[model samples]
Target: MILTAPVSMFAMLMTYSSNGSSSRPWVTPLVLFSLPLLFASLALRRAIPALKRSPQGSGDRSAAAVALCLGGLVYALALGPALDNVGVL
Candidate 1:
């Protein structure tokens, strides 16, 4: 779940970068690729509390936090660009 977020973010970044000259081309790919990222974020959100409750999961907790923040930042960065790319903003 944690790993999938970055992978999806990379896919989105690559697609958005290489999508020159295409019209309304990003909607489909964005919808398709965003699913994994969304799922990863949801899964990580659920896991964080569980990780905090377990003594052995201290490392896992930090890893999840980092992954969550990374995913969130990517989402934040993508928002304006995506809206601009789609001409919706």
Candidate 2:
């Protein structure tokens, strides 16, 4: 929970930052799409633990699951534009 939130925001910011002209345009998007898929993976990490600890249908588990799914979806959706910005796609 603590770790995933900041990383999610950072990934989106990096994705958004790629729209601007930089000396090395690939850097931001590259960070956003780093190996091991840290951004979305962290959200999954948070969700898994919450799922184990919280009871089924509880608000905490539900919120964590929703956060993970939505975060992954947003990241997946952003990838095309971010890649296209650097001509990688």
Candidate 3:
């Protein structure tokens, strides 16, 4: 959900801004939606083996390299505040 997470977040932000509402129940689904991406990342690490490597590696899993890290960071940053807002953190 490297693409899906942020796109969904941007869409929600745009919707909320237009309506001028400070509240957003729409954001909660993004967290739930991220589960599949998380599992897929883990599965990729296990199946590919190369994806878990360091800079010393010769063979790299190029496709997953940036997207996984970037996606996880974005998901965490967005999810943390959302959870805290709902008193779930």
Count of clashing residue pairs in every prediction:
0, 0, 0
Better of 1 and 3 by TM-score: 1
lDDT of each: 0.63, 0.68, 0.61
Per-model TM against the reference:
0.44, 0.47, 0.36
Which regions of candidate 1 deviate over 4 angstroms? Answer: 1-32, 35-39, 55-57, 87-89
User: Per-residue alpha-carbon lDDT of model 2 for 1-89, expressed as tens digits?
Assistant: 34445665565565555565545554455554564356567888788899889998799999998978877886776577677767888
Weakest 10 consecutive residues, lDDT, candidate 3?
54-63
Task: Show where candidate 3 strays beyond 4 Å.
Answer: 1-63
Best by TM-score: 2
- Model 2 residue runs over 4 Å out of place are 1-24, 28-41, 85-89
Model 3's lDDT to the true fold?
Answer: 0.61
Cα lDDT tens digits, model 3, 29-88, are 554456655765675565355566645444456655655675666567666766776779
Which sequence of candidate numbers ranks them by TM-score, best first?
2, 1, 3
Best-first order by lDDT: 2, 1, 3
Displacement of residue 86 (Cα, Å) in model 2 is 5.5
Q: Best candidate, lDDT-wise? A: 2
Stronger candidate by TM-score (1 vs 2): 2
lDDT of 1 by residue, 1-89 (tens): 35446665555565554645554545544554476567667866776785678577577777767767776775666576577777788
